[model samples]
Target: MALGSLSHGFSDWAPGHAATANHAPPKEMSEEFGRAAEAILIALESLRSSVDLAELQREYLTFIQIILNEGLGSVLRGR
Candidate 1:
């Protein structure tokens, strides 16, 4: 898959916002947050199916592991 496409997918899946340099927003409960979490899971599953580990190079597998462990794992942990 194209890197641009992946990046675009992520941007569309979770759009970022600009925050104040020293101020963090408080968390609030919302159904939208739940939907966003579901969207992330769907994206991850789509990516997993597209990647063929058996045919992937070692470095590429390591990259995938880093994304899964550091990226997705942190989100799942509510960090």
Candidate 2:
């Protein structure tokens, strides 16, 4: 909850942060990531709203990895 500590925590994505000086992803790639992230959220929301959707086959193990690495990655790669 401390302000000073937050700098380190948010260094990566915070706009204009020194830590992201040259480490930031390219704009095109980041924009694609943004789209993919949004898609993942929409997928989860759809599942949550469906009465009988039940659980999703979230790949081998990790949730984000399934959505981001596989589905989204394939979708974005086509673009």
Top candidate when judged by lDDT against the true structure? 2
User: Could you give candidate 1's per-residue lDDT for residues 1-79 as a string of tens digits?
Assistant: 3421242223112213244323321133223333444454555565655455333323333333333333444478999
Candidate 2 per-residue lDDT over residues 1-79, each given as its tens digit: 1222222232144334587546644456544545544565565666666544333323211333422343345477895
TM-score for each prediction? 0.26, 0.37
lDDT (0 to 1) per candidate: 0.37, 0.42
C-alpha lDDT of residue 66 in model 2: 29
Q: Which stretches of candidate 1 lie over 4 Å from their true place?
A: 1-29, 49-79
TM-score, structure 1 vs. true: 0.26
Candidate 2, residue 48: how far the Cα is off, in Å: 2.4
